[model samples]
Target chain A: MTEEIIIAGFGGQGVLSMGKILAYSGIMQDQEVSWMPSYGPEMRGGTANVTVILSDERISSPYLKIVDTAIILNQQSMDKFEESVKPGGVLIYDPNGITAHPTRTDIKIYQIEGTKLASEMGNKKIFNMIILGGYLKVKPVVKLENVIEGLKKSISERYHNLIPLNVEAITMGMNNIVPYKIEKHVFQN
Target chain B: MSELKLMKGNEALAEAAIRAGVDGYFGYPITPQTEIIEYLMTERPELRTGMVVLQAESEIAAINMVYGAASTGKKAMTSSSSPGISLKLEGISYLAGAELPAVIVNVVRGGPGLGTIQPSQADYFQSVKGGGHGDYKLYVLAPASVQEMADFVEDAFDIAFKYLAPVLILSDGLIGQMMEKVILKPQKPRMTNEELIEKNGSWATTGKKGRERNIITSLDLQSEKMEARVHRLMKKYEQMEKEDLRFEKINCDDAEYLIVAYGSSARISQKAVELARAKGIKLGLLRPITLFPFPKQALFELADQVKGILSVELNAGQMVEDVRLSVEFKVPVEHFGRTGGIIHTPEEILEALEQKIIKNGSIRHHKTRKSSIL
Candidate 1:
């Protein structure tokens, strides 16, 4: 199976690192993966995004016009990437700063209050991990063990003590995701 | 041997150079390629392997430093993006004229000037056709993957030392910035000064001990002497073209149309080839690994079998001229490209192939076969 995922958020939201962790997890599973970030001066305090592709076979073209999944964290990203998700695909968003909700009915939508939960947990840095956990809850593309191993590889040795907290945050996110169902009557008329 | 690790192309290149026993690295920071020097500095190769890494004040100074190190019979390298590479042309020409063995990497960005930091192959003509003055050719290797970005460092150094000429690793920001898994080679120690003196003593200046004073200069005032030197250089280039031509052919056995590209463009066109083939159109890809000693002879032979050829690139149109020259006008050769760091999608490339090359009906049998496939 192949999953083309786009993760977009503000610069300080760890969007690029989240995609990198997922790519490392794919490697742990002996799968081919590529991580390409939108790099430049604009990445500082601006909208940062990354495209990560995990496939059983060799991946071609790291850049894609359409993605199977979009992990959006901000309203700008929600508005920009809503139409780019493939039909019948999945879209996960954190209802933290998103003012405009996704309106696409053909795709599946889920919301996790990752920022609020992370604030409640007393550590705001684990926000991306929570969002990632929400994604894996709906579609378990990779095992939790591999993600833990991925965190070990991606994070530095000095930060090893924080893994348990990050793991707890991930579990909380997985348990708290709310499926956003669209009413049929809205489009029926 | 080291275990596989996920790394960016720039980082892998720096690590491979250190592992390949390079004596020194001198470079100035440039966009999309600054990671190479950053990795080197962070690793502190000087402490581990006695390898010297220096950040020069400018690209010109960096290349001159490479020239000085290479003159001492040491393996040295430098890397830069397009605008910085332009500043290095004069030193590069001097290196070629002096027949120095060194490696240079161009992580190409969009430019005729300081255009953009995005990836581009617009330097194809400038790189392969001799960017500097005079008639000299650099052994140009184009890497499409991060694995090759790591592996080609050793290969480029080997070829540079074997031929005693400068070699270039031609890549773009796409390959420079993207991350992938790479299996790194085992560490090798740098050569000692005595080894350099013994191996390259015939031409190298190693204190002129126990021999006539050896001189290294590209200047020859006599007309006939310069003419003979040019002829010798031409002969070496001819030999390299014959023995060092490298390319890859995919699904070409039964292909009716061929796509020619290199580096990142090759990776994109590979997807387009797969898409076209899935729709029952017989399309194939020809990727040239060495852009200088280009796979011209192979393209000439393949031109006889394919009905048409389309050249795709990130530049406006540079390598297409080489492709057309290779085919010698026997087949319908067309060009499609995007410039100024804009990359073309696979669907757009497929559409271009269908509209410009396939639907032109220049090949009599292809029109009927196309109808059956569609």
Candidate 2:
């Protein structure tokens, strides 16, 4: 199955990094993945967003207007991406940041207080990790252990000690999910 | 020995140049191509092989420096993107006219003017069909990945020295910016001064001792002499066509449809081939490793077998003309192109193949058809 995702927020909210983590995780799993960032002036302290495609098959283009999943961490991101989610898609939203509601009725929206969870975890910067945790709970495209290992590998040596804290956040987030198996549709002839 | 390392295309090009025994590297800093010069600077100090790496003040100075270094019978190279490459055309034309051996790289970006710093294959016509004035040709190699980036540099230099002509490595920003695993083979050392003076010292400005001082000039005062020079260069190109043609054929034997592409477009076309194969369509790709040689004979042989050919490119049908020239009227050749420095997707290429080559829809007929062949 093709997994297309968009992780968008204001600059410095770790949107691009989140997308990179997902892309790297996909690559580690031996799947074809491409991470493309928005070009033009949006790259300079502006609204930074990244589109990531992870597929079992070869990816044609690294672009998509209708994403299967969207993780919105900020109000601007929620406002921008609310309309782009495909029918029967999944959206992970930050209730503490986004005030607007999704327009589509076919999507399953999961609103979380990411800011509160980050504060409780003793670091506000780990909010993106929390989002990833929630995303993995629903979709579980990659193993949680692989995502944490990728996170540790991507960071500097000085931050290597923080792996346990990140794992704690992922474990806490996963514990909150009530496991449900959705029938995944495959486009096969 | 081959060593595999993670490198961007620009870095791989620089490392390849060093491994290919390039005597000198002259270039200016341009986005996407900056790493080439950076790689030279980082690697130049530790080099026991005695190579010269200089960052010129501007693109013009860089190309002219290449011209000077090449005139000295030393293997010299330069690199830039589209705009910077445009600035080097005057020097390129001079090098081609003088029949000098140099390796030039154009890490292509969006263009016409100061286009965005993104990947683009818009300079296909300017590169393959002689970017300079008069009649000349460059040995062009389009590389899709960082692996090809390192591999093509050696091939380009070999072709340049064999014919005493300029060779160009045509890559794009995507290849330049993206990182991939590269396996670089152990490089042979540079030629000795005595050996260079012996081989190319005939026309190269070495020294005027017992032998006459040969002036390295492209200017021929008499019209017949200049015309004769052009014909000689043409003959060298024809010889290259017969001897130095390089291409990669993928499952083309008895295929119903064929896809013709190069560089990054060729990589995407490979994915299209896999996708089409899964759908039970017999598809193949002809990736031209040497753009100047065009692989005309191979394409002609395939034309008799396949029903049609789809020319896929990142620009608006520049290489399509070359494919049409090769096949002539034997099979219908159509084009699937994208302009404005945008890359075409494999799905888009597959769709084009399904609609044009498979369904047999008549696209724009090229006027240059049969003008070169039949």
True contacts kept of each: 0.60, 0.07
Candidate 1, residues B1-374, lDDT tens digits: the string is: 78698899999999999999999999999998999999999999999899999999999999999999998889999999999999999999988888889999999999888999999999999899999989899999999999999999999998898888999999999999999988999999899888988888888777886899877777878999888878888887898898887899988999899999999999889989988999999999999999989888889999899988999999888999999999887788889988877888888899999988888847645666699799
Question: What's the TM-score of each model vs. the native?
Answer: 0.95, 0.79
Task: Give DockQ: model 1.
Answer: 0.73
Calculate DockQ per candidate and list them.
0.73, 0.18
Q: How much native contact recovery, as a fraction, does model 2 achieve?
A: 0.07
How many pairs of residues collide in each model?
0, 0
List, residue by residue over A112-187, the lDDT tens digit for candidate 1.
9999998999888999999999998988888999999989999999999998988898899899999987655555
lDDT for each residue of candidate 2 in B181-234, tens digit (9 for 90 to 100): 567989878988889889888888877777999788789989999999999999
State the displacement of the C-alpha of residue B132, model 2, in Å, after optimal TM-score superposition. Answer: 0.6
